[model samples]
Target chain A: MRQSSSTTDEKEIRETVAIILQNFSPLKENLIPILQSVQSAVGYIPQPAMKQVASFLAVPAGEVFGVATFYNQFRLIPPGKHPVKVCLGTACHVKGGNIILEEWKRRLGIDEGGVTQDREFSLDRVACVGCCALAPVVLVEEEVFGTMSPSAVEGILLRIRIEKERRSGCGGNEE
Target chain B: MKTITLTIDEKTVEATEGEMLLWVALDNDIYIPNLCALKARPLPDANCRLCWVDIEGRSAPVTACNEPVYNGMVVKTGTERVVRLQQTALELILSTHPVDCGRCGKNKRCELQKIARHLRTKLKQKRLRDISKRLPIDSSHSLFSYDPNKCVLCGRCIWVCKEEQKVGTLHFAYRGFAMVVTAFGGAPLGEADCTMCGRCVEVCPVGSLIFKNAEK
Candidate 1:
C-alpha cells in the first residue's frame, strides 16, 4: 500500500472525525463501534481521527491508534477506487483462496495487502466475509465471486482495467 | 422515536422506539434464530448470523441482530436465503467448536445444541478439527471451568464479563475465525485478576465456559 504523509489535510481529517462522532456517541465501550464507523467513513483511518476518538472515548490516543492499527482489518492508506478482498478464512484457505490471492498479486503487480502503484486496485485479505459456502471467495467492490481460479483472475483484472480506461475516456484494449 | 411495521413469517408485526428486527420477531413469536444475542445486552455485533433474515431493501441477508427496523419492511425470517445464511453461520461456528457437547454438562441446555436441533443441521460439511492444539482449560477455579475450544466467538462472555461484573479480564484475543475470548496476556482464568464472578458462565449461551460445580 502507498503511504501518505503523516500530516494529513486538516479539513479532511475534521470531516472524518465528524463522521465518526455522528455514528457513535461518547459512551464508554463505544470504542469498537467508533473505530469501525471511522474506518467506514474514511476509506482508511487517519491519525487525527484516532486522537479525536481517544478524547471522545477518554482512552489514550496512542491506545486508540494502536488498536486501530493492531487489527489487520484497519488500513492506514487510502484504498484504491476498487477494493479487492480475498478471503483467507479456514474453509477458503483450505479451498485454495490463498492461491487466488497470489494470482491477484501477480496480475496487479503488487503484494497481497498492498495497492498497485497506479492506485487502480488495492488488495487485502479478510478472515471471512461469512461466505465460506462459496469457498475460495474473492470480493471485488462488494460483489462476491466464488471459486475463483488463477485463470479467472486475469479476466477480472482485465475487466477492472477496461473500466479504468473507460473512465479516463481512453478506448478499450489500450492495456 | 420512529416505528416500523415488518412482516415476520408472513405475520405483520410492529416495532416501536428503535427495536432490532430480531427482538421484534421474537416478540411476535416469529423465530429468528440467534446465539450471540442475549436479552440483557442487545448489540447487533452481527457476529452470529443465526438471526439472519431476508429484507426486501437489502441486497444480502441482513442480520436481524444488527439491522434496525424500517417502516414497511418486508422481512422473511425463514426463507431459503435466511436458512442458507443461518445454516452457514451456525455451521461455521460449530466447525471450530469442540464436538463433546454430548458429554458436556450443558448438553441439552447448550444453545449450540439447541440451534442444531432446531435447524435440523447435520455436520455434513467439512470442518477444522484440530483438537491436538487445545487452549488449556482452567478448571482450578471453584466457580467454573474455562474451555476455549467450545467457544464460538459469540462475545457473550466478554459482554457479560465486562458489562455485568465490571471485569474486563476477558476479551476477544484474536481476529476473525481465530478469535478466542481470553484473559489479558493469555493468563488462565483463575490466575487472572478476575473476581471469580460467574456472570460469564451465567451469560454464556454455549458450554464453552461453564460452571464446574454443575458438571457431573
Candidate 2:
C-alpha cells in the first residue's frame, strides 16, 4: 500500500510540473517564477521537479539547483505535515534563539534543514520573519510562538502531536 | 562607441561611455581592490563591496564595478572613506575564511592575500568572530579538488561555469551562512557533468578550488 501511494504521489508531482511548465516560455528569466510556482503548488521544491525544470528550460540541472539554493525562498526538501521554523535574526540570536533551536533539534533528533523520521515535522532556521519584537520566536506551521524558551519546544511538539492524533481519530493514544 | 573622459584620482582617463567605472579605472592603470569583478565576463555580481569609489555630486561611495562611466565625472579611488569600507569588507570576508595561508596552494598568488596586503589589514581576523563551514574537502574529481572551507563565496566561479563555459556544473547552494557551491544534488564534482575545464579553478579568488596535480 505504501509503495503504491508513493508512486501515485510521484505521478501527481509530474503532472503538476507539466501544468506549471505550460504557463511559461522556455526562457532563463522564467526560472525563478517557475520555481516559486512549483513550491507554492507543492509545498517545497522537490529534486525531480528541479530536474524537470532544468530540462524544460534547456539549462543544466546544476544551474537550476544553484539558482534555487541561492535564494532563501526555496526549499529542496519535502516539508513535513507541520513545518517548524526558528528565527535566528539579530534580535532573536541575542535572545538565545540558538538555545531554542538546539532544543528543537534534540527533541526531533534532526539537525537544521532536516525532516523527522516519521515525516511529521521538518525543522529549519530562518534569518528573520520580520517579527523582531517577538524575539526567540518559533513558528510551528502558521502559528507563531513568541519569546520562546528551550523548554517550550517540547510543549509545542506535544500539542501538535496530540492534535494530529485526535484529528486522525486515534484519540491521542497509540497502543 | 562614444568615448567619455573621466577624472580618476585627478588623472584624466578616456573610456567608452557605458563602460563600467571599475574597468575604466583599471584599464587606465588605476587600482581598485575587487574580487568578484571579472574582466573576461562583464556581468558584475557586486557581492564584494570592495571597489567603492567616491564620485563628485554623490553623497556616498559607490561600487565602481556596477556604476557606469559618464563624461566629466570626477571620481576619487583611494579616499579615506573608500579605504575604510574596503578594509571592513575584507575583514568580514576573512572572518569566515580559514587563515591557513602558509599551507594553502595559492599562498603567494591568492587575490585575497594581495588585497589584504594592499589594504594593510590585520591578517589575524580578530575584528569579527571566526565562522568556518567545516565542510570536508572534496578530492573526488580526478583533475581537481574542491575545498569549501577556503571559499569566500565569490560568484566568479559560478559565472564562469554557467556563462563562459556553459557547463553549469558548479552552482551556489543553500543561502546566507549555510551557502556553498556544490554540484547538483550535492554529488561529487567528478561525478557531475563537469568537463574538467578548469575555468572555475582559474577564476576562484581563493584556494577553495584547486588542481589536483598542484596540491601540496
Tell me each candidate's TM-score.
Answer: 0.55, 0.79
lDDT of 2 by residue, A78-132 (tens): 8877899999999999999999999999999999889998888999999988899
Which digits, one per residue and each the tens of the lDDT, describe model 1 over residues A1-175?
Answer: 1235434555677777776587677876888787777778777777667768877887545446446655887887778767899999999999999899999888888887688887768999999889889899999988899988889998887887777767675543332
Candidate 2, B62-128: lDDT as tens digits: 9999999989999998899999999999999998898988999989889888888888887677879
DockQ of each: 0.05, 0.62
lDDT of 1 by residue, B76-140 (tens): 87778778877878777777776676688788888877777777786434554543227677786
TM-score of 2: 0.79
Task: Highest TM-score: give the candidate number.
Answer: 2
Q: Give the candidate number with the greatest DockQ.
A: 2
Model 2 stretches astray by more than 4 angstroms: A1-12, A23-33, A40-43, A70-73, A81-106, A111-113, A123-175
The ten-residue window of minimal lDDT in model 1 chain B covers B124-133
Which ten contiguous residues of candidate 2 chain B have the minimum total lDDT? B118-127
